[model samples]
Target chain A: MESWRDNRFVFWLLSLPGTFWISLFFIVPLSVLWIYSFGEKTGITDVAITWTGQNYGRVIEPVYLQIMWKSLWVSAVSTLICLLLAYPIAFAICFAPDRWKPILLLITILPFWINLLIRTYALLAVFRTNGYVNKAIGWLWNGIDWLFGGQHPFQPLELLYNNGSVIAGLVYVYLPFMVLPLYATVERLDKSYLEASLDLGASQLRTLLSVTVPLTMPGIVSGVILVFIPSLGAFLTPALLGGANAIMIGNVIETQFKSANDWPFGAALSFVLIYATFGILALRWAITARSKGVEF
Target chain B: MAAVLWNRTPQGPLEYSRRLWLKLLLFATFFFLYSPIAVLIAFSFNTSKRNITWQGFTLNNYVVAWNNPDLLDAFTNSLIIAFCSTLVSTLIGGMVGLQLWRFRFPGKTAYEAFMALPIVIPEISMGVALMAFFIRIGWLTSDVGWPLNLGPIIVAHIAFSFPFVSIVVRSRMVGFNVQLEEASRDLGANQWQTFRYVLVPFMKPGLVAGALLAFTLSLDDFVITYFTSGPGSVTFPVKVYSLVRRGVTPDINAASTVLIAITVIATVLAMKLQAPTKAAKG
Candidate 1:
């Protein structure tokens, strides 16, 4: 079949608008940010491109380093939790009765479409000091005291404004990102392989560990990257839930831009994140390529 | 036949327990996913202002939210931004998708990779980058007239959203019969007429779905909008964020419920439009 390359003018006309828009708005801005990463702040409102590494140098200072470390730790923990929770749910959905699959899938995706801020706000309502969680716990405590005739009053547990709450918020918001990729991979998995393993005398647990997990490695990798990257750069979750002590790298970058007026430093920090993202993607690509080569 | 016979056999105790456990886990996960939103929705009608405890049902929160001028203005800004971004992104992205589907070109892989960049990078990076770009170009400064205001925010949204539209439209073009276009041309139609009459109808479902997706993305966006928007162009999410920082109130809950309802309706409509195509394909 002849391609649209035969009509070069029409092809250019079709492609040029999007290309030009992305170049001006997306690529040019990113390039500007890249240049500013090596710049220095000259005054209260002026940033001079002095080609300094001091901005990146400042990133390794103990204070900023600690925040970066904490961000990685928090993102890793939340991503791990998302994986553990999502795997079973994805597996269940893949194996669900045909008629129920759509409904279950929709339920999984609906929260994804909901606004992230609204969802985080909902978490606030659930985990506040006098929130529903404490209310229920307090009620249970009263019931126990009534039975035992205790004199002490019930104390509401402090569930919000901490690292734990921030982690919980990340896991909540990014769970669907983990689930959808897993569901796609698991749904495409061959059932006959599982049956063959069972017939070959492998226990279910053994088969899952040795066979199913390996087969779903691509999905696992994608899910982890999706959840981990967002959690690492999460601003609202930490701002709303983390209070004072749980500041992540994202919040710090935001501070540089908004209050500190350190555009150069913020641009440097943003580049660090962008580089990290590229590194992870490259690692995934290399792994996938190696695995594909092994198939031959 | 063997598979049917195996399915008819009774499950052992271990298998039965495993199945039960799986079902329970699925139930618990769903509950975890949904219970917070359910609580938020329920409390939107709470009579008390604090929203710390349940109170008698009232519609006053919604009434208050409706009457708040700042909230209304922010919401109007969001709608205007979403509409403009959606329309432009869809048209530009649709053209890109069509070109990608119908042609082979040099450096195609690089072009495709560049298109995916906005999606792959963290949004904060994009937000700050755009902000910096606007400032560097003097578009975001107080003195600039044309490129100032909501222009940068709208541009940022279009940059992020058009890639998604391209993806959807391209996928919709898969397995599309090119013969229809040939037949239309043979019927004495010009290139413009063929596209308008033949191609547009085939691409309608995808276009609508992509538009809905873009609209929701723009409306729900906070980070990009936060950085790109000037003081006069505060969006709904930015307004809500400030309100949240001040303190949680039932009216915020009321506002949130309305936003959620809009998003859910848009998503469901997009899904409904997508469902028929999948069914037909299958």
Candidate 2:
């Protein structure tokens, strides 16, 4: 083996380009954003470094707090629904026959290849007022009316441009991110252990709860993180599917930077979002570590 | 025989119901996953422009999208940017992957955590951060002269895309057997020759997967491109977003269909290339 010192130069040379790019594009900008959060915007396009903390204060106000709460609530509900729906499917895939397993997994993951924008737009095609779903509902209602000699036709349900649709869109987009990890964990589970449990007179329900659930905790956590963080920061889905009242933290940030032109306040709002994300992740880690009796 | 009968008789109907429940769950999940895309693909052929109501089926939307000059230009820009960014990112990411796999260095964990930050960070935050960085550094608004153009967009794409490439390539490299490299070197091969003849072939699947992933990501990306791209640098997704915001048009659906088709083809090809590596791992 080559001496460790000799490889050091090669390491520096190889890593320099990627490191430089990330630092310039990611690190430096995040720092700049942090600094900007302290500055005050003096004019339409200019921000003066005032070292004031009012921007942070503004973010914690009742109105902004309400938005933040709404964002969190929506994301939590979406993540919960996705987990409920994905777990069963992942379980099925884990136990599927050899001939059907790959196909089932592929069907679950293939939607991820499509662009999120296109997928959301597709959701619109289904949820729109005059869309296919409402059309079917109208047809069914008309059929009932004809049979019962009703005088009036049924009106379409208001599905699109609502908070419910927004959450649905989020769940639809993020289900795969939840499923793939859970599938891997479930598939790699020790079958012998499960069989042993069954042989010892443990019921399937007991084995699933006492053994399988505990084993898959890591997958469940990862799936939650992957789904929740993005859902929290979701902009496009809420914009397209949510009505006037569906603004989230992401939309506020976008509005500040793009329309309001308040870069400093925008930066402050972003810092809050960033901190919230890190805080949630760290809390989860700490909780998991404590439960496992492991040093974090 | 007693145990078998005991197993069969203990809540027999319950077991059957559980199995049926699982089957139904799988079916419903698949339906939810695919129905939106199926709807989009089906509606791309709809003759209705303003409504989702079925008119007579027609190929006019595809023809319209094809003939649209602005959409075509956006598509061209996306292709060029994706190509250039993929090349640069893959090259740098490959080197980084090699470095990460081969060398033991001080602060390696720190370096890795830093590398992983981008993947975990929200895209909007990154987009805004990069946009702010561009403006603050006078990359976009220099008193001397304007430097921001397609250059910043390409740089941003490389930044995001390279991390993915590095992760994929590095995962493969972790499982790589170093004996093959040593044997190649022992057989009178120079450094370049060893890399060319041994490492390249070993890394072929990973490299292809990384390249395809980077290409699709660059193509599908909207948030970063929206923030970083100047007036002349609108990509296809950006164009699609704008069209979508204006109204639901059949042309957008047609464009989306084309985009979906390309990504699906790339994904299939990547899966085929990756199958061998997966089997080897198993």
Candidate 3:
């Protein structure tokens, strides 16, 4: 078959619009941000390119570093929890009847399509003092009190506006990202291997740990990347669900651009997130490459 | 002994327990996913002003949302932005996908990596980046009148959304036979004619799916839109976010339910369109 190179005019025509649009609108803007990171603020509305390292220098300050560390901790916790919950769900979907697969997959992905703001708002309704969670617990407490003929009063558990709520929100939001990739890998798994293990007198737990987990490592990595990166930079989740003390790196970056008016510092903070993302991706690539080398 | 045991019964107590555990996990996960949405939808009809308790059912919230001009205007802005961005991104991204698939070029790997950057990076970074770009270019300044409207938001939406379209389109082209194009050419059809009649028809499903995805993403976007939008260009999500900061209201719930319904419908349609291709590949 003739290559598209045989028709250079047509190929260039096809490529020009997309290349131009992405370069101008996408690449150029990100480049601007990169430049801003190295610059300094001149005035209230003016950021001159003074070529200073102060912005990045401030990133290592205790206040900013603490926020960044907290962000990492929260994201890692959420990603780990998402993996634990999603693995079993993915397995169940694979083990389900043939006709039920699509429906199950759709159900897993449905919440993903819903607006993030609305989902967080719904959590507020469910976690507030007068929300459904507290209401249910109160009813249970009253029932026990009546049974024991006691006068103990029930108090609502503070489920909202905390670090725990922020982590819960992240897990709730990114669960589908973890499940979908796992489902794909688990579905494509060779069942014969499991049968062989079982036939060889391996326990179900042992077989799962030895065979299934190793085989599904790719999905686990992809899911972790997908869930962790977004959770790290999550603004709306921490903003709406978290208390005043629950500010993450994303919230700090948002403040710089909005009320703080520190565009140069904000740009630097944003670059830190970008760098972290690149590091994780590079780590994944190295691991995959090493595994492939071993196989060969 | 192993063969005899296997033949006697395929099911063991451990397997049974494992299956039960998986099923319970599945049930719990689904409940976790759907319960909040159910509560949100249920509260849309509550007559309570503060949404703290259920104060009987009424359609008044939907009426109030409909009557609010600002909310309606924001919804209209969202629709316009979603429509415009989807159309432009689908066109540009379709071409890019075709170019990448059909030809080998210098810097192709670099270009592909660049395209994926928008997707892999944090969206907050993208938002701040575009805000800085617009400010630097003077388009976002208070003095700029003509280019200071919805143009920047639409541009940002296209930038982020087009990569998704390219990915979907390129994936759909995998393993596609080139013989169809050769046969059309041999039959004396011109290049444009063959492209229009053969290639476009083949790419119809991907194009539709990509467009639907782009549209849904643009409509659902809040972070990027919030940064790029001007005073007069508030989209639905931005409007909702501001209202949520003030306090949650039933009208917001009504608006959210409507958005949810639209997204569900669009997603179902896109899935239906892509289902046949998946089955064929299988």
- My TM-score estimates for the predictions, one after another, are 0.95, 0.93, 0.95
TM-score of chain B of each: 0.92, 0.89, 0.91
Collision pairs in model 1: none
TM-score of predicted structure 3:
0.95
In order, what DockQ does each candidate have? 0.58, 0.53, 0.61
lDDT of 1: 0.88
lDDT-wise, the better of 1 and 2 is 1
- The count of residue-pair clashes in candidate 2 stands at 0
Candidate 1 lDDT by residue in tens digits, A223-258? 998999889889999999997879998999899999
List, in order, the clash count of every candidate structure.
0, 0, 0
True contacts kept of each: 0.70, 0.62, 0.72
lDDT of 2 at B30: 79
Off by over 4 Å in 1: A1-4, A145-152, A293-296, B1-9, B12-18, B143-148
Per-residue lDDT for A158-188 in model 3, tens only? 8988899999999999999999888888878
Residues B1-282 of candidate 3: C-alpha lDDT, one tens digit per residue: 443344445655234223555667788888988898899999999999888888899999999999999899899899989999999999988888787778887778888998787898899999999998998787776555533477888999999999899888887777477899899999999999999998888888989999999999999999999888878888999999999988888999999999999998999999999988887787
Ordered list by lDDT, greatest first? 1, 3, 2
Q: What is the DockQ score of candidate 1, to 2 decimals?
A: 0.58
